[model samples]
Each structure stands twice: as structure tokens, then as C-alpha cells.
Target: MKELTPVTIRPPFARYAHGVEIPAHWRIVQTSGQLGIRADDSIPEDAYAQAVICFEALSEILKSAGMTANDVAHISAYVTARDHMAGYMRARDTFMAHATRVPSSTLLIVSGFTRPEFKVEVEVLAAAP
Candidate 1:
């Protein structure tokens, strides 16, 4: 497998890369929507805490796939309320601080989740060589 490359268009879009080019033979690992629930099935109260937990869960999934946050090519984040957007962004930035390349991302403010307690849910797509 070859290394992944981040694509940047002429006109700047956002902080994240416009797209990622994955080389042939690379394996793609797509994770399910990860919530803030802990191992004991307990969820945090605040949006920030929930966002952190969600990212941690995503990290665990990537690790299981022999990948790291740096291998992530795209990310989709969902929040229950609009007011929680800032906190969610902070948590996401913190979680991705050490990444070599930031992934293309999408953020949405949704009405609710499967569980009422869940304030944040994150899904990630990773490319592994």
C-alpha cells in the first residue's frame, strides 16, 4: 500500500483538507457512530465531556484496525443541540491535535440520537496502508 495524500484546491475551503487521495492496496476502515457512553454504559452530562468520550471511542476503534487518528481520512460529527457546537469543536480539535494530516470533516446539529443522554456521536473513516 502507498501513503495517503491530502488534496487542497486552489481556493481555500476550510481548515480541513478538501479531499484525501488514498493509494491502491490501502485498506479502508469505517467505524460506526460512536457515542459518549463508557464501558459501563454510563454517559457524561455535558456536551464537551460527551464529545471527548465519543472521540476516545473512535480512537479505540481505529486502534483495533491497526490505525491511528492520523490515518483518518474523513469524520462526521453529530450534535444534539446547536449550542453544543463550540464545545464539540474544541473537543475534536483537542483529539486531533497530534494528527499529521487533518481529515475532511462534516458537523451537523441533529434533533436527537438513539438515546436521549447522548449529546454527541462521531463516525470516522480511516485508510490504512
Candidate 2:
């Protein structure tokens, strides 16, 4: 009797992959740390607002890199106000909702930022297929 093959067997398909492997090669792109400066070089006065601004800027950079928030592998957030931690997280969640996968992140509270008017700054690393 001849062996029969399984009719349900199918090859896997990659979709929205975070990375792709090639023969003896890998292309990687690392972006410069982005900040919350508007086209006119204006920054928001509030920390939460500044965080939003930073996220917006980072989003654009990520898009340009052939990725989105879902591709973000890690992130670092700096804040000057410790009491406003809740507000900062709220903003983060809002921004992350647009992503396919929520990336790991770190948050730090500092006494001051480079600009007195700026409240928060965020840096991110992303990879995509």
C-alpha cells in the first residue's frame, strides 16, 4: 500500500513580521534619539503634553523606518515630575493603543530636563520585517 500524505498540511505564512532572515545577512537600522520639538522648534509647556509631542515625533520616525509602534522593542521615558506619574502612563497607554504589540518601556523621574519648559522626553528602539 502506498503512504498517504496529510491533506491539511500547509506552509506557514509570515505577516506583520518584526524581522526577516536572509542568507548570511541582516539589515538593521537604528534611529537617532527623538525629542518633542515641533516644526517651528516649539515645545509644549506641560509634561504630559510634551510626552505626547515626543510620542508623535517618534511615531513619524518609526513609520519612516518601515515600522510602527508594534515593532518597538524597547523605550525609555524621562520625566521631571514624580507626582504626575499617573498622567504620564495614561498618555503612554493612549499612544500604545495604536500599536500591534505594546513594547517594553522604562520610566524615570528626574529633577529637571534640559529645557525648563519641557516636561518629558522619550527614546525608542524598533525592529521590523
Tens digits of per-residue lDDT for model 1, 1-129:
222333443633444665667778899999999898899988889999999988898888899889988898888999989988888889888888998877878899999998899899999888988
Superposing all C-alpha atoms, what RMSD in Å does each candidate have to the true structure? Answer: 2.9, 11.0
What TM-score against the true fold does each predicted structure earn?
0.87, 0.70
Query: Candidate 2 regions off by >4 Å?
Result: 1-29
Q: What's the residue-level lDDT of 45 in candidate 2?
A: 63
Alpha-carbon deviation at 82 in model 2, angstroms: 0.9
TM-score for candidate 2, please give it. Answer: 0.70
In candidate 2, position 4 carries an lDDT of: 22
lDDT, each prediction: 0.84, 0.63
Give me the displacement of residue 61 in model 2, in angstroms: 0.6
Predicted model with the maximum lDDT: 1
lDDT of each residue in 31-123, candidate 2, tens digit only: 565555788998866667767777788888877877777666666777778865665677777777777555555678877767677667788
Give the lDDT of residue 89 in candidate 2.
Answer: 71
> After superposition, which runs of candidate 1 have C-alpha atoms over 4 Å from their true positions?
1-14
